[model samples]
Target chain A: MVLALSGAAQTLDSTGRATTLGLLGRIDPRARLIATLLFACVVVASHWIPTLLIALAASCTAMVFAQLPIASTLKRMAAMDSFIIFILILLPFTMPGEAMFTVFGFPASWEGLWRAVEIGLKANAVVLMLMALVGTMEAVTLGHALHHLKVPERLVHLLLFTVRYIEVLYEEHVRLKQAMKARGFKARNSLHTYRSYGYLLGMMLVRAMERSERILDAMKCRGFTGRIPLLGRYEYTKRDTVFAALMGALLMILIGTEIYHAV
Target chain B: MHIVDGALSNPVVVTGAVLAVGGVAYGLKKLPMEKIPAAGVLSAAFFVASLIHVPIGPSSVHLIMNGLAGLILGWAAFPALFVGLLLQAAFFGFGGVTVLGINTVNIALPAVLAYLVCIKGVRSSNLTTATVWGGVCGALSIALTTLFVAISLAMTGEEFIPAAKFVFFAHIPVLVIEGLLSAVAVYFLRLVKPEVLGAFEEVKR
Candidate 1:
């Protein structure tokens, strides 16, 4: 939620960051879904290195087809999601396995470390697939899909409002935080902070509730009756089906290969 | 956190998907049409709450008030959380479809714990009790949730975080952050809009 919004307003203002993350937060909706599905296949096939590499290769090829900017994509992929990236980097230190090459007095087990890398890459692969795919598409599209998928009316309506207002709340959070800071309010690391946070949250909740009604009123006046309009219909052509099938078959092959190698 | 595609066992993931669907259905069955406005507002509140990242470690983690959810929504927290998790999965992909149940259980643990705190443990005389205990509940909630998830992943024979499930031991500071956040949220709810607390208490009732 933060990524998409900041990417749009702040990052997009800077050509450098925009070009880098553009592949992720700027893909076509249809392509995004396909890529997301393909990555999921890789998740199931993770046991095999050959399969994992093959999936990665396939993702790369798709990235090429998607016209993702190579330099910017790689750079942004690393820079933007640094926390998960850090967690990935930390896995080798924690995992237990046989000896690999030691660096700076750290006994890095190749097995444990490589496994960490695999997990990390798998995590990245999912992100890339989404970035390369739907990271850029409007979330409302997914909400609409949720509606068509027969998600509960209450749930879908809640979801639609949540996503829409998340941005609003983010902005509110920033303005409020700024105000707090400007007023010399500092959040200490202790139990006492709860009162302020609770009170602030309550206020935010009230404001958010009022906004929801206003937004609903505006939307209802404009003919939104708690339902997202089905914007465009997606068709499964034989070729698309064939492609999907081939992808599935390939995933199965990878799984089989991984099991064979593991055994 | 939304678990991504194929992140955990298909059975675990599918089970969560199934239960998440059930949670919403269950909530819907019980939802009074009159509270639709509050429900919508809470949903939006939840989205924004998560957007505001609370500092943890050298980095930050978003606030997910499963405790507050429990305190206010009681069983209804199930549906709210399910929707939030679903969005996180679809949008940011923090947690996955497979780990949904596990995540839900993890988050819901604190929420229900908070419910227990408000009902069985804490005194309603002081809003501070709700705030303080709610914070504790929040901290313990995610801590347990994370512990359960790490253990579950290990049990699944998946190598995601093969280390001891005691990452929550490392997450004490983070959980404290959650406790503080939840307490504040609950405190404010009681102070100005005591009605919200009334509604919340009624849920526990």
Candidate 2:
């Protein structure tokens, strides 16, 4: 229970941190979003170490220019990269190739090591780009950007509504858990224990259902139609153009290297 | 169980994304106007549910509840699970943004299967039968999810076969746990608020 609540809190904190204004935050969200997608494609396509290194460098430069909280951002990046790191640690021993060295009596190979490094680089580059670009904007701003970008309306609304009520649902779950504990409920590997948890989740859904009725009624009373109007407006400026051009050039170069190697 | 970015080949990612888009469109079309808020709230429920980690023998596994989502939402499970995955990527980075399509397809498709496979038994008159079927739905969903994850990984390269196998073996306990929990949940709802099952009836029609 503690772990669950703490996870929710951590999610809130990290996202909340990203909403604060930064250099990337100043750019039109639409432009930043498009660039972020392009950067991800570039990172995924480019396998050359030099190009990947350049992508990493460019992402780092964006982070610095955004004036993001360096420590927290890196910490978040580390968390995201941890799984890949684990894979990297294991791949060298399992993958068949020319041996690099012996690690703890296990044969490590150059092929596996190189593959891990390439994947790690690509993963970090994409993650860092998102952190600098999409992460800088507020959730509402991001949603509006999607709305303007002609993303399906239902999806955009669903994303916003989910973001809006995630904390509320977390609090409700915490309360339900507390009530269970107050009644001396303990989960064991048995049918009775499973039944008790089922009651807990069922009760949550019941409550959420009732709450939704009230919310929908309230929205209707306020003259809300089916569509949510986006209040954010953006214009194309020199800054937007410059950012797009730089990103386009970088992606072309990355793709060029890949094609060069393939041929 | 989410797949991170840069983990999949381009062909796999593109195919998953295209399929996901189709699924979401179908889901939105089936969803009623009044039920839109319910979808959001349930998405939040799914997200929070995934945060609660249950300790097994050695390692802890988080609750997915995709089976529950599927049984309740039907085709709408596509959008509901999609929202949860999107928030997970955007907020905590548990999954990456680029792989959102594949992750959604992998997770939500199994859920829809669970709904199709177990709905009749879940709605049965016999209480024991209903509960048992609910358990099966829950268990089956996880089994299918792990299978999809494994397949996606294997498709990327032969090198990932071991990792794919590892994911399946690791989730053995999760399958049982979800089965039992979802059974209990279904039984409880049947007694307390049977109308909730009607959420998926329109989709069936």
Candidate 3:
């Protein structure tokens, strides 16, 4: 509940945080998909520090290779990262745990505070790992990986179209916002503003839907069969599998450690 | 609310994926060939509804018309909203794949409720009265959807109880917004696309 609404209006499109670490190498769609899979694996494997450490090392290595600048990376965090910070701060005060210190007027609990910190760090790490991969890989290659992963064909096609169209949608949103502003939408900073926003959003949806239907119709007319040749599969030779296996082994070790700590 | 990929536990994700597919499949099987276009358009409407944001507190919000959808499409909105949700997950990450079914059920159930209300209560003679009925049903359905979602999350215990509790609390405004929007939307359709709105004779009309 909190998590969902907290995410609220600012979805991923707003998170244009600059990366501090950049790895060199052009990642195709396949590589990007592989990276996403790998990233998900590492996040789950946080149960084991060995895998996480190995992942952390790979992340740093990838960052250095990518040549990500610190200023830009920090800028990204500063803008869109506040919500994450908000969650972290709130967790300490609200979560049930041992009281650590009284700051100003609030009692900071040790368990809650550290738990929040841990979640925050993990989240940042995941974001960093993704930044390393998303730009490095091509969308096409990743599309192929998804195909092999047995994701639906029509769905992939929809995703391909969606990814392509999102920028347009964002641009449309911007134009609408500007139009609303021009019409004297003084942001009175209240819930009353929600009514106007709601009306505008309703209009926006109708407009966008009309646009999408036209687009779909156009595609169908052009012999679109709801399948896109989005990517070519990269054969995972011994190199890829061995790398994956090594990562898996490391994860087992890390999970072992987390369990030990819990015990 | 949009869920992320790794937010829910694996079990939740797997279960959601299965049910979502199953629901949509079942719904699809029930749709007549002629109803396909209407369903697709309604699905698009459902998807577009989320993109619009209403300003609340410090941020903006948009309509989540799972209620209206269920009102019109009944069980078919299950699949329609499911597909719409899946697209959101991939592109927007509003919610994860695991939580898709949960979210679908949450939103679509109200839509069904609204459908029931439209038939039973919205047939009043007075225009204002009819619209009010629509608005109340719209708002109540959305509130109900949010409540169900919160309850589901608490039942799972994966999400904090506070979060679920806040879902209903937070929807206080959304209810007003959705209720008004549904009435206005239906009103607009009555004026312009009454045929389209009436096309769902199974639910209303």
Candidate 4:
């Protein structure tokens, strides 16, 4: 399990390699960001299974257009599913409706089952669209786009700084973990194990705090007057217009279908 | 404990979004120019720390450590933790986009509360005294977080009530683990460099 976790951590480090290599990649980050927000809101508001399935399809298409690795992206989506699977499985048994089946002497409702499926679909559709649109961009670019989108300057600065250091700190964590392993530290369900892990975390935080002091002095020396000037310029090219128009039309279709189903 | 998009009712999501914005704004207000780097680096540290999974009986749970975060960051825990969640959603897909606001509030509010409730105890000069307080903060934050998550789920629909109750009960072990880890971590910090614990107080003064 530790090996698997370390492997997962290694993959996390490579998120920086999410390249601007496809159709969605060439579109403006600001446009992509807005489109993703609109897409998520619309998808969440949707009720019909068919509409949601279509939304999921649309997101899958976005993933393809973004040139995201298919198996691994879906694996990430499945990982999220693992967290909510318990709640979803409980829904059918707990919710009141016509009984679909009996499990362990409990009746499972069709209505509850449908509700679970709806939630699962809505979640996947929205998450996939978000990953395809925003996750494909560089973290720094996302920060710049948020800045352009008029998210508060301070918040954006915080985001930029956090993004800048995540990889560095993650590496530090890996090194520390390696050193602990070298010392024959095997984590188990015991007080000693927990305390060791605690000390490990404390040591990391202390080092991070000390590192921040040096960073602050260096930034001050470089004349960082309360704000790091955002240096990237984003232009809405023809591709952006086409992407925006297409996204708007897709969203309208979703809303229209949902309204049509309601009325 | 991320409440994904579409699981929450519109009113719940909107309310959460509004509260989160207010919290982040306030947190940013308390964060001065000189302190941004400190907060940012520490935020990154917490983000990395969250990846550490401690073993239980047959399973393991990753650390949330929002309690430790609160003890160190104070009100600034709001934006710092929010940033962590945002990055998680974007990169890792642990949480969704639309529900980002509620997830932020659910996790970060408890962190801020941990700060308010346990800050004094954590700042005690004695090591054991401060360590116990850190455990309380850690356990208390997780308890509150689970409650908030359950409330969000139950508010969305009557059907979610059972699932909501289960969420809290299931996390009891995690609460204990976080408490133990936080206590020792605080002990180490107090022994090694007492300044980190007092830095927030210095800034406030």
Candidate 5:
């Protein structure tokens, strides 16, 4: 389990690789982001199978285009789906409608089951769409894209810095935990355990703040103001335009079908 | 409790996003220029806080630490928690992107509330009072977050009502753990760096 977690951490730390297996990976990050958001909004707006399936297909296509490692991404999706498992178990029993069958004298509703599946599908689709669009880009590049898209400067900087330092803090946490374990700190339902964890967190915070202060001083020494100069200007290419057109067409079909069904 | 995407109905998600935007705006307005680095570091702290799984009952639960965040960051908790949630969703897929707004509101709103409820007490001269109040507010924030998450889920569909209630009850153990964690954290911070208790005040000024 520890090895698996460390491997996951490595993937997170190395999210900036420029290599990709699909054309989507090569598009302007801003455009890819816009398309992803648009697709997600549409996905949320409908519960129709065809529309949801199309959205899923589009997301999968994008992922394939980006040449994302399917197995790892799917593992992540499965992890997120853990909650839906509960929803699936409970929804059938609680939903009031035509009973599918009786379970322990309580009737399971078909409507409830369908709704759960729809939600599950929507969840999976949105996660995949995000993986395809935002997940493929470097964190810094995404921050830059958001900045260029006129997101708040403070928010952009906050995101950039948090991403930059999270791994560092995680390492600090690991070291602290190891030290506690080395000293025979076995976790149990006791005040001693909680307090030990608390001190660990408190110490991490203190260390992080001191580190940030040093970083701030360094930035100031280098003539750093609050605003980080935006990096990596992106120009829309022919491929980007073609991708946008394809996305627009797909969105229209999905929306048109949704409206048609509503009528 | 992070509300994943597609779990909530459209109206709830939209309302959550709108409210979160308001909270973030207010947080930004209160954020001092010099405090930017502190905010970032704390945001990272809150994010990493989730990785430490404390043994609770048959399983362990991670600390959300929104209460400690609230006590230290005040209104700045809004943007601080939002950034953490965003990165978690993007990098780890802990939560979905579309539901970011509601998830932000669910988690950070309670942090803001915890700030209001315990900030004065945490700054008290009496160490015992500060620690007790820190624990109270820490647990209260988790309770509030659970409530918010429950409401968000229940609003999506009636079937979720039982699940919603279960969520709250399920977190009762977490509340106790969080309270203890916050109390000790407060004690430590008071001894080592009392100024952190006043960091938000400096930012507001």
Candidate 6:
């Protein structure tokens, strides 16, 4: 998991340099963000199997359009599924309906099984679409887009600062861990281990605080006026309009399927 | 403990979003402009810290450390943690986009509660008392967070009750590890640089 997280951080670092290279890279981020949100809401509201399958397919198509590495992205999605798998597994046994099978005197229900499947489809589709759409942008660009989308200035500034510093702090943590390893410290299930980890975090936090102080002084010296100016100019091009229309049409189809199934 | 979108009932998701917005608004209001750097860096540090997987009996659990965040940032922990969650969802797909609100509420609300409950004791002149309080804060925040998550799940439907209970019970070991780790970390902070623990106060001033 730690290695996986480090890989995620590395990806985030590379994303800054990899900007505007994919198929969706030309589309306006604001349009992508709004479209993703609409798609997620519509998909979540839809319960029909056909609707969900189409939604999942749409998300996969978006992933392909964004040029995200399919295997690795699906691996990440699988990791997320591991978190909720327990609850999903239990759902069948807990819900009252037609019994599918008996396990240790507990009967699993078809209705509950379907409910779990619905949740799985909805979650994967939304997260995949989100990654392919807004996640493909640089983190700084995302912050700027949010700022332009009427998110608070302070919040955007915070997001930008956090995006700027995650790598620096992550490196600091790695250095600390390496130093500990050099000192023959090994992590295990013991009090000594936990305490060492705690002290490591403590040291990291202290250093981070000092670094922030220095950063503040430097920014002040430059006469920063509390607001970090967002300089990204995003133009809504013909491509963006076309993309939005296509996504809108897809969402409309999803909603229509949901309503059609309902009626 | 991220509750993904579509699992939660509509009302639950809406209420969580509303509450999270309120918390983030208040948190940003309390955070002065000058303090943004400090808060942002600390938030990043926590984000990095959360990636550390500690060894349990067999499997390992990644750290949350919301208690430590609360002690350092106070109300600002809300937005700081929310930023972390947003980044995770975007970059890692660890959580869903629509359920971002409920996830933030589950993690950050307890962090603020820890801040309110343990800030004074954490600033105590007595080192032992402060360290113990720090442990309590860490344990308490995780406890509340798990409880909140369970409540969110259980509220969605009757069938989720068992899953909710399981979520809470499964995290018992995590609570202890967090408590111990937080206590020692607080002890180290008190010895090395006491002012870091009083960060929120300085920001307010």
Q: What's each prediction's TM-score?
A: 0.75, 0.89, 0.66, 0.95, 0.93, 0.96
Model 4 regions more than 4 Å off: A1-19, B202-205
For residues A1-263, what per-residue lDDT tens digits would candidate 5 score against the true structure? 12121112223335554343356667888998898788888888788877788888877887677666788888988888885588668888999999999978999999888887878888788878787777777677778899989999988888888877887888888888899989999999887888898999889988888888898899989988777887668898998899889989999999998888889
lDDT of 6 by residue, A1-263 (tens): 13332211224344344336567877898998899889888988889988999999999999898887788889989999999999999999999999999999999999999999999999999999988987777777788889889999999999888888898988889889999999999988988999999999999999999999999999999999798877877787899889988998999899989899899
- What tens digits encode model 1's per-residue C-alpha lDDT throughout B1-205? 3333444565666665575566567666655544444565676567678766654536666677676666656656766676676566544545543455666765665565556656443336676666676567677677766676566556545345544344546566667777777667666766665555425334553
lDDT per residue as tens, model 5, B91-145: 6667887799999999999998988988889889999999999899899999999
Q: In candidate 4, how many Å is residue B185 off?
A: 0.7
Give the best candidate by DockQ: 6
Residue A214 error for model 6, in Å?
0.5
A80-153, model 1: which lDDT tens digit per residue? 34534444455566566786767787766777666655665565566555544544445565556556556566
Q: Can you list each candidate's DockQ?
A: 0.39, 0.54, 0.21, 0.67, 0.65, 0.74
lDDT of 4: 0.89
Q: Write the per-residue lDDT of candidate 3 for residues B73-94, one digit (tens) a residue.
A: 6666666676666555433324
Q: Could you give candidate 4's per-residue lDDT for residues A148-258 as a string of tens digits?
A: 989998889888888888888888998998999999999887888998999999999999999999999999899988888987788878898899899999999999999
Superposed Cα deviation of residue A211, candidate 1 (Å): 3.1
* CAPRI classification of candidate 6: medium
Clashes of 5: 1
Q: What CAPRI class is candidate 4?
A: medium
Which candidate number maximizes TM-score? Answer: 6
Error (Å) of candidate 1 at residue B108 is 4.0
Candidate 5: stretches off by over 4 Å: A1-22, B203-205
What lDDT tens digits, residue by residue, belong to model 6 across residues B1-205?
9888789999999999899999999999989998999999999999999899999998899999999999999999999999999989988898887789999999999999998999999889999999999999999999999999999999999999999999999999999999999999999999999989858654334
